[model samples]
Target: MDSYAIKYIGLLCLLLAFVSCKKKNQNSLPETMKKDFVTINYAKGFSIEKPASGITIIKVYSPWPDADEAFTYALVPKALQTQPQLNEKEFDAIINVPVERIIATSTTHIPALENLGVIDKLVGFPETRYISSEATR
Candidate 1:
């Protein structure tokens, strides 16, 4: 091969190497972008009280409408006997409840609840006409 041909081959090889490197970097993402959890310190405004063994009560504002009282619950780690079938692996970690009773407050939640075969548990609803389908009604 001549000097020009050798030079052209070297240039082509360098271009291919750069293209492959760029493609590899595009496939990989940073750890911060992949993280799903967000930590928040909300203990500043709330008053913590110890009731008994394995019971800690905290007074906090309600996240729902028409709630006059501060929400209180027994913060305990309960074990699950049976596992539910979830679409994604992350959903298994997040959802711990059996979801026996579901209150459809809006039209958007009605159709999905009906499809999941748990429509009978929907004892309370906002408005029928807004979410009532032909079959659901």
Candidate 2:
């Protein structure tokens, strides 16, 4: 192979390694709690951590290249879910899991919801014209 082809292959290998090695939260969890955390499949820019205390933490990384902020969500147990607590301020958004209904704002989100087989969870869209998917209608 030419020098340019060899260089391109080397560059591609480095790029793949960088993306694959992206850091994940390293917070320690109890052995018992680790088994209860739901495994998120085929997802990017998010991580879930559940402590034995019963509250679940979800960290969502901003997809935008220019955005430096990431959002945190705390899912409190049913009994204490309604009561506001001091730590609630740390989360960007928090609510009970199995969110009943949501207004899907973009078409790009449709595929992810569809892939999760939860397209029925969407109750509305900002603009109907952009939704070309018949399944979403």
Lowest lDDT 10-mer window, candidate 2? 29-38
Top model by TM-score, which number? 2
lDDT of every model, 2 decimals = 0.55, 0.80
Q: Write the per-residue lDDT of candidate 2 for residues 7-123, one digit (tens) a residue.
A: 999999999999999999879775545635568898778888877666788888875776799888887777666666526578887777657787888899999899999999999
TM-score on alpha carbons, each prediction:
0.30, 0.57
Evaluated against the true structure, the overall lDDT of model 1 is: 0.55
Worst lDDT run of 10 residues, candidate 1, spans: 84-93
**Clash totals for all models, in order?**
0, 0
What is the clash tally of candidate 1? 0
Off by over 4 Å in 2: 1-46, 61-63, 77-86
